[model samples]
Target chain A: MRKSTAPIISIADVKNVLGKQVVHEHLNLDIMKGEITAIVGGSGCGKTTLLRNILMLLRPKSGSIKIFDIDILHCDIKTSQKIRHSWGVLFQHGALFSALTVLENVQFPLRTFTTLPPKVQKEIALLKITMSGLPLEAAFKYPSELSGGMLKRAALARAIVMDPELLFLDEPTSGLDPQSAGAFDELLLDLKEGLGLTVVMVTHDLSSLAHVSDKVVFLGEKKVLAALPLQELLKQKHPLIQAYFSGSRGESYVKSA
Target chain B: MNNQQPAQLSFDKNTHTLHCSGSWTVSAISDFLKQPPLTTNKTNRIQIEGGGISRMDTTGAWALHQQANALKKSGKTISFSGFSEEHTALFQMVEAALPEKQPRPKSSRKPSFLYVLGKKSVDRYFSLLNGLAFLGEVIVFFGRIIMRPARLQYKSFLNVIDETGYRAIAIVGLLSFLIGIVLAYQSGQQLKTYGANIYIISLIGIAMLQEFGPLITAIIVAGRTSSAFTAQIGTMQLNEEIDALRTMGVSPVIRLVIPKILGLIISLPLLIILADICGVLGGMLVADKMLNISYYSFLLNFPNMIQLQTLLNGLIKGPFFACIIAGVGCYQGFQVVSSADSVGRKTTKSVVQSIFLIIVADALFSIILPWQSV
Candidate 1:
């Protein structure tokens, strides 16, 4: 892939440890603007850990993480909070505030970060809810009342309610059916073009990586093994990369791609 | 300066048209809506020109929808021009998905006196019935163990004893000792006025042996053991661990509740015995120091003061209060709903209910056992 003039996110020399066990060491990566990047790895390979580190929820033992050129690891609380407004995160479980209705969940960040009138805030929240393909009536229902698909959509609505420049999705399609996952992928692409968002997603779905990801970062053996476009990465002669792409799940999608 | 103009809504009196321009995202809309530029009620035929609008999102769509609704409400006909296909689609999508207005039921400020009384009485009646049913199930669980001693979970019973009974000894011993000291100190002062100071020994011995020692130990266990049991089982229920046990054909009542019940039954009396010793020792020490009563004199009267019946009275109440605490805690655990908050609420309810029922049971035992005649 051609290099962009500047990357939206930059990580270098990152080290992560949980007690005595090292999860990641000397990991380096850059994510460009308006591109969807997927981080894929074997089970327990710390994909989620890296995502948490970049989101500033977890601090690595040693590393520098820059988001939109701001040093995230060393920032003051006020600066970090201000920078957080430009990004959105969709957790694996939806993680909607259980006590709030769907509309209230979507409106939470808007209420916290903006001084907009309540009427306008509600209207905007409703609009985001619709854009995420949820019915208007769902706005009144609590998170527990929603089905799995509706919960993901409601979570998506909340993530994008602020029109964030960067969006992080953790296993967005893991539990979804094929049809819904396809629709979700199409929605991501549409949002990318329409709103010009930069997306970083942790996904195990090979078909999603083949179809939606501009670049795939493969983590293994306590470090990043490779970062390349799906096609090029599949073509690599590395033994681990070869074994991964030759697997039954990857074989089916690789043939189709 | 001109290029940085956020967004504006201006009307031309000649053409009856409203033109909006600049960024119309959330931040810009907030500024523009502070003092809205046009009133749609003033015109019947209005044209909205969006040619100058630069950046728009769902928030902008919502803004336009709000404007359209305001215009339509006042019987004004409006038209949009120069909006892109994407913009039009986004605006129309939000417009179509607006929540339908529903008439809310009016809530009265004060409920009628009869309503409050009826609701509360019904709630209390059902809760009482529920409690009796839970107690019956616990008794049935013990009956099963009696019939098939091999079915008893000996390992888990020991585990619960280690957690709730053994771990709780320190606090129980400390609190009962302090109670003994306070009782002797306060009563000794008043007894001296009547030249009855030596009676402080008898008073301390009888009270600690028959009431305060066991009562204090049970109360501490109620707060410690019962709350932990409730929180543990409630969290298991939340995570479907209890459901998993059921799916494997293991009855939760037999596997979970029985062990806890048996543990508390055995541990409560044993812990009470220990607490009684600590309480008697505390009173003797206080007497030796405070009232100039020597330890030898205190010990000489101690055995006479503490009759075998008095110790038996306190010990008999042990397993009963243990049953109440363990039973209430586990019952409240099963009562937990599917939420993190429900676990907390049920734990608190378990502790309060256990302590309350323990005191009530103690009162009933005292009344029925003929404490005064003895």
Candidate 2:
């Protein structure tokens, strides 16, 4: 696949201090349009924090961050809402509304943001639900009725129901079995290619990193250690980057690279 | 600043094509869908010219599909022209997944009166069955706890007592006290007119002890403690903590429900006693202010007119009311199957059921006990 050089998200010299601790300092990163970027880190290494910063969910102490060429830090509420409408977020636990069935959950944003007639909305929602690899019967079931993999699929359906240009997934494959996780990665790739979506995912799953990530950003020591393609990032001389893939489990990815 | 032009379709006469134009994204399609975009009335073979379309999304694709289907229904053969690769892929994906015609969502129309009555009766019958099953379990576990006291969850039992008993004192006392004051004021007016102002003691005392004291305490606790019990237990069930207890060879009833049952059984009577005292004190204050009756005179008259049996008659219902509240609350908690939605719904049902049962029990108490004090 040919990679686009156009920057979809750019963070310049960002500083994030949460309470008494410095989570990230001088963190500069760029995510290109149409690339699947993975933010990988150790536990408490602030993968979610960086994702939150770029998502405009957290205010860094200092920096300029841009998404779709618009300055996210200084934008007003209306502009922020427009930015929000253009992107989709899938939380770690598949945060579907408990009361609504999967179909209703997928249709929620469409109903809220669009003036589409309900009939067309249902058609679009059903389309997304099918594209997410869920059975049509799953649409009528509530979130609590779904198993782990089904929950993820339902959440992914809701996320992309708007046909968002950008998709954010947190630990998308964390709870699924390996086969299901691999299938999820394949689904992610299919979505990114078919929908022309730019993906930014926070995941520890090396399989996901190897399978789908077009670019990898390794976070450590309160900043981005390196941001490169998967094969290229594996060659980094930095001890932290090396240690990230030096574990008995991680070595398999490094060796495969 | 999304200043994109809304999508539009223009008809061309010579080629028999509908020229699709402008931004066809979801944000812009709102105004386009208001008026039907098809004007292929004359043409037998209509072509959609897509080169003029600047932007499109899944919503746009779906809209086009719908418009195309409409044209096809009128016996017009439709084809796409100048379509980009992305648009074609989206169109194909939407078409592949789209059901020919989706069934409309189930209507929320009201059912017939007989249907509602039958459904409600069946629902109530099941609730009664569940209540009986839950009551049987509680009795069995209560016997076990009495046989071996060490098996009881003493820490949780103390916690429940502290929560249901000590924490609830203020609201229960204040509400019943207000009721007492209102009672004294209402009856004092009639007593003063009859030149028997001091009879306000018997009027307020008998009413407070025989009816309002225990009844008010049960309702307040049902609102407060019963709802809390239901919510706490329902959330535990939702989180599978109750399941965790069961897996560990611990009975959820002995550990969770019994503590609440014992605590409320012990605390509610204590609360009723506190409410009774506060109720009388409020009545005494109102009598002093409104009827020229001193606190000393009110206290002296209390022993003469208000018999011990009147006090016992109201106080006796406390444990029974507590059983109703705790039983209904815990039963509803057990009924939560899966969702946080069920927890919320069950919590509401618990409070309603507990209060309703408490009222029924109060009515039975009045019927069984004679009106005259022994």
Candidate 3:
């Protein structure tokens, strides 16, 4: 998590455009190995778009994204598999396969990528399922059958089932009630400490941003305005950052800190 | 340092311990579990040595835990020694995260075959009753709209008619015309063999106007527009759009279903008339080409050969077939459960059920209708 450590992911001078509208220009960011870095921004600031760029769901119009020292934007599908094997992604909508049960969803990557026997695979998947705070009985349930909080937990279990060193989360706690959201933040910290994972998440929840992230990347003006710890970034004099954290709902957390 | 030394495991048989060195990480697990540690019968306790380990992931730690569990099951006590604090914590975490054995209340006895048969038959009967209940709901909604007049959805009515009506014209006409040509050619050949080629006019007219035109048009609509209705409403149901309408104080049955029923009723009879015209033209073309019947002679004999009642009987089936098609499609759409898989299944059921009902209705008309005098 230290600044001196080599970055697990680095983006240099990226430009992202969608249909003549520029989302991000000259965007540069770094995610150090073994840190929880969060991308937080206003509604249309393209936080999810930036996450997609790194995940290679959408490649930026220009610039480079490197994860585990591999230049992902220019890599072939075969080369990308190496990065894919080392990291797991949780989509905003809990994009768990609707057709598969939660246990089968967790076991999918291990069955496809690892040569471990099936019995061991089930053991590891169950471990992750319990670790993510889902009851084991819920494992056989379909995605549609799960509540919003349960859906996120199920997706988290599947994401970490492979024990990847790098994890990317897009709005991991967006739709849940406050109690569940706090529980999810605690779960995130636990996973980060337990697995020694380097996490990069896109979220707007101020409480989670203040509590969980080792570093916060504030996106604004189509670029990263500040990539600092939450307290340090909050002290900046910029009108946009000031207005963002000054809102009635988000203010108490800042004042409480 | 992510890639450290390859893992090493050694059994110190004299000390009753397993010595592990180098990186015990995820990549090494598949091979690591293959070589289980060896212990002699004299040893009552097993110790796993982890001091010399260079790296470890949760996977490596979990796999090692499984090995330790296996040793414990074999009447040997298991313990870990010389692990770095981080590695020890990770090992403990993996140990703590293991799923608890839960006692779910599962049904102990399987149902008998006779029970299953009885249940299936009851389910089928309920589904039939459900269909009639759906029809009752539609008729109630239809009556309400008729009484209120202002409650009718003109926009959706126009949209539905445009979709299942104007858009369907080309395919219906093409198929009807092709049937007409085949009917004319086959029957005219027989009439020519008997030197009664002019009778081909009566044969082609009766078949196209009295039976084939409405049946063919209905079958095509069953396959095309009916399936579309099912998929459209099924997807809406999946998206909770129907729920959204309900929360807004809108009646989903009136807003979604009734307009389709009305639109199809009005559009189908018009389409049946168009089908009849296309069929007659195709018959005339084939008659002139194959049997040497001139257009002028065909036109002169057409009214005498086929009466207006023949066309009217076929058109009468149009509204009935349309009602069945729309009713079945919308009903199946409402049956779509939460999953996307259900949408596909319901759409298939919609088409099959529509065609089946259409054919049954057609058979009734064939048997009991006063077509013989006409």
For TM-score, the strongest prediction is 3
Give the local distance difference test score of model 1. 0.85
- Which model, 1 or 3, shows the larger TM-score? 3
User: Which residue pairs collide in model 1, if any?
Assistant: none
Descending-DockQ candidate ranking: 3, 2, 1
TM-scores, one per candidate: 0.88, 0.89, 0.91
Measured by lDDT, the strongest candidate is: 2
Higher-DockQ candidate of 2 and 3: 3
Order of all candidates by TM-score, from best down to worst?
3, 2, 1
- lDDT by residue (B289-368, candidate 3, tens digit) is 98889989999999887888788888889999999999999999999987878898999999999999999999998887
Residue range B1-374, candidate 1, lDDT tens digits = 01235767788878888888888776667887676535755669999888888877667777777777777777889899888766776576566656666322246378999999999999999989998887788788789899998998999999999988889888888888888888888888888778787787888888898899889998999999999999989999978899999999998999999999999999999999988988888888888887888989988887776678888899999999988999999999998877677888999999999999989999998887756414
Candidate 2's C-alpha lDDT?
0.88
Q: What is the interface RMSD of each candidate, in Å?
A: 4.2, 2.4, 2.8
Which ten-residue region of model 1 chain B has the weakest summed lDDT? B99-108
Question: What class would a CAPRI assessor give candidate 2's docking?
Answer: acceptable
Alpha carbon lDDT at B180, candidate 1 = 86
Off by over 4 Å in 1: A1-5, A245-247, B1-7, B12-23, B34-37, B40-55, B72-137, B146-155, B370-374
Cα RMSD (angstroms) for every candidate in the order listed:
3.8, 3.3, 3.0
Give DockQ per model, in order: 0.33, 0.48, 0.51
Output the lDDT of residue B339, model 3: 80
DockQ of 1: 0.33
